[model samples]
Target: MNEFLLIFRRDFTTAADQPSAESLQQHYRAWKEWFENLAAQDRLVGPTKRWDGAGKVVRNAKDVTDGPYADIKESIGGMLIIKANDYDEAAEVAKDCPIFAFGGNVEIRKALS
Candidate 1:
């Protein structure tokens, strides 16, 4: 099997406009369940990493700027590596990602050794 990286993207600007606490809990539960399922299937390669939606971008050897290209509609929220047979399979696996619930998306890419 090959390793694939699932890069989750979402609009962080609206993160503060989240639903009620109960709704947030439900979302968290869904995410937990998804990760648990991946672990149970022995597909998860490592722990998911969440981003704070704030960072700097290195443009050159010295030039730097604020990250996630502020002008963009979305930014990378998190990422997870998983084992899969191929790109198609990996994409299929990402289809059920919880990010979709918030109008986000997962960018599936094969990991290079």
Candidate 2:
């Protein structure tokens, strides 16, 4: 089996663009169920983690800045690794990701050994 990285990117930029608290709660539940399903299928690998809104950027070993990013409207919500037979299989698995429900996207990349 090969490993794949799934990066969840979503837009929660401004207050006006953010989802309601109740809607967020529902989305959280969906994520929980999705993880559980992957676990049950023996596909999950390593650790799963969600990122905070805060961030820092380092440049040329000198300059540093705080940011989620001003250039990009969407933020990286979280990421996790999973096992799959190939890119095709990984793509199939990613199709079930709940991020789609919230107008987000899942980027699937193969882990090189």
lDDT (tens digit, per residue) of candidate 1 on 10-73? 7757657566889879988999999999999999997776778888777667978888666687
Score every model by TM-score: 0.88, 0.91
lDDT string for model 2 (1-113, tens) is 99999988988877777788999899899999999999999999976788897797777998788866657888888898999999999999999999998889989999998
Query: What is the Cα-based lDDT of residue 61 in candidate 2?
Result: 92
lDDT of 2 at 14: 70
lDDT of each: 0.87, 0.88
Which lDDT value does model 1 have at 106?
A: 97
Return the lDDT, model 1, position 5: 88
| Candidate 1 lDDT score relative to the true structure | 0.87
